[model samples]
Target: MSDIIRIQNLQKAYPGFALEGVTFSVPRGAVVGFIGENGAGKTTAIKCILGLVRPSGGGVEVFGKDAALLTAEERGRIGAVLGENCLPENLTAGQLDRVMRHIFPHWESETFASFLGRFSLPQGKKVADFSRGMHQKLALAVALSHGADVLVLDEPTAGLDPVARDEILELLYDFMQEERRSVLISSHIVTDLEKLCDYIAFIHNGKLLFFEEKDALYERYAVVHAPVEALQGLKDAVVAARRGEFGASALVRRDKLPAGTSAERAGIEEIMLYFIKGERI
Candidate 1:
């Protein structure tokens, strides 16, 4: 499948932090989860993709067009929800709808109205009166109202309760029922991504650590429980390990594991924690 979004060696530098050689792609008809800890450059990489932050080096492309060069019409095909709401607090949902109709050439009032009703958002109530979850739902409704082929969401589900998060995820799943639709969602909530994503891209300290199909990532790594001595000899295979009084548990490459050693399937959260917090053997 062709990529809807492609980021190649994208770089950005601040006074103290830098996004270093990031690269990943969101393929058509799939949800690609962008996962990392806070300060891992997930947001920066996304901003670069949206042309919000100027990259110091490298490139980003959306819909086969360079992101920086996308025309207004090309940009209309993409919808984005950043961390901030960016909507006027004094404006009611009804007023926002009117403004959006003017902004997006393909805006659908019927679709927006349906989403507001489905999400239980109040059209006449000012945005300032809505709760965080309500604001998020409104933002999502806005993003979906326009005829967008791709969604770029940064921390879209953050600060939401389980029920609300699930509702939002269900909306995304429904959006992808149209085979050409795609999404690039960045969040620290690995479990949510685990449920909705076909591919996972991990970033650490502003660098792209790995990007692979979710199933392949699980297949490539395993968590093994063995003696510390056994783990010591397999340093090359061990990504991270924890030692205790009884034994050692390590995240290791499946193929490199010793014969007869049993390894359990590793979840995305477990893998991420080990890679971020555990000691490398």
Candidate 2:
């Protein structure tokens, strides 16, 4: 499938932080989960993709056109939720609808109202009066109402309760039912991504670590609990390890383990923890 969004060696810099040549893509009809530590450049890379931040080097493309050069109509084709109360604070949902109609050529007021109803957001209340979760839902509702072909969501579910989060995920699932629709989302909630994403893109210390199929990532790594001696034999395959009084637990490549060695399945959270904080072999 073709990419709906592409980042080529994306780079950015600040006083203390730098996004160093991070590269990845969101393929058509796929949900790509962006995962990393808080300071690992995920947001910076996202901002670059949306053309909200100017990169010191590299490039981003959306819909086969340079992100930096996308016309207003082309920009309208992408739906973005930036994880903040970014909507007009003083405007009621109804008023915001009226305003957005003028901004987006394809904006659908009925779709927006349906989403508000589904989300239980009051059309008459000002956005500033909404709770955090309400704010998020409104942002998502607006994004989906614009007839966008792709979604760029940063921490979109941050303040939502389980039921609401599930509702949002369901909506996204419905969105992807159409061919060529895609989503790129980042969240601290790994379990959510595990359920919704086809691919996982990991970044660390300003570098792109790996961008791999989620199932293949799980198949490539396993958690082994064995004696220190057994772990020593698998050092080459161990990505990270921890030693305790009884034994050592390590994240290792499944295919590299010696015959008869048993390894348990590893979740995305466990794998991320191993990469970020686990002791290196």
Candidate 3:
């Protein structure tokens, strides 16, 4: 599939923080998860992709054109949910739909109304009176209501409860059934991403660490629990290790480990923790 969004050597500099040479692409019909600790520049990178923030260097491309120079028609094909409270606070849901009709070229009132009903949002109430979770739901409703080919979401499920989150995930899954839609989402919630994403992109300390197929990543990396003596022969294989009183647990590359070296599959969060907090060999 062709790339729907391409970020090449993307760079941004801020006082005491910098996003340096991060590169990744979201293929058409693919859901890509962006993962990182707080202040790791995921949001900054996203902003640059949407042309909401000017990059200090490098560039972003969407639908084969420079993101910053996308025409209104091209822009209308992309939907974004940036934060929990991103919508206008004083507007009622019904009023916002009227406003959005003027904004999005293909805004659908019936679709928006259905989403509001599905999300249990009140059409009569002003947005300022809604809870944080309600804000997220409303933002998502608006995003999906507009005919969008690509979705760029930053912390889209931040304030949602488990059931609501599951509902939203299901909605996204349904969206991808058309086989041409794509999503680029960043969230601290790793399990949600693990469940929904085809690819995972991890950034740490302003750098791109890895961008790989989710299943392939787990297949390549594993956690080995063994006695320290047994682990001694696998130093080269160990990317990160934790030594306990009785044994050592290490994150190892499956290909690098000796034949028959026992290791269990690692989850996305475990792999992330290994990279961020584990003792490197």
Cα lDDT tens digits, model 1, 1-281, are 99999999999999889999998999999999999999999999999988999999999999998999998778888988988675778999999999998999889999999999998999999999999899998999999999999999999999899998999899999999999999999988899999999999999999998999999989999998888888888888899998878888999999888787778999998889888888977
- Regions of candidate 3 where Cα sits further than 4 Å from its true position: 244-246
Q: Which residue runs of candidate 2 sit more than 4 Å off their true CA positions?
A: 244-246
User: Over the full model, what C-alpha lDDT does candidate 1 score relative to the true structure?
Assistant: 0.92
Q: Name the TM-score of candidate 1.
A: 0.96
Q: Assess every candidate by TM-score.
A: 0.96, 0.96, 0.96
Query: lDDT for every model?
Result: 0.92, 0.91, 0.91
RMSD of each: 1.3, 1.3, 1.3
Per-residue accuracy of model 2 over 107-170 as CA lDDT, tens digit each: 9999999999988999999999998888988999999999899999999988688987898899
Tell me the spans in candidate 1 whose CA falls farther than 4 Å from its real position.
Answer: 244-247
Q: Give the TM-score of candidate 3.
A: 0.96
- In candidate 2, where is summed lDDT lowest over 10 consecutive residues? 254-263
Least accurate 10 contiguous residues by lDDT in model 3: 226-235
Clashing pairs in 2: none
Q: Please give the ranking of all candidate structures by lDDT, highest first, separated by commas.
A: 1, 3, 2
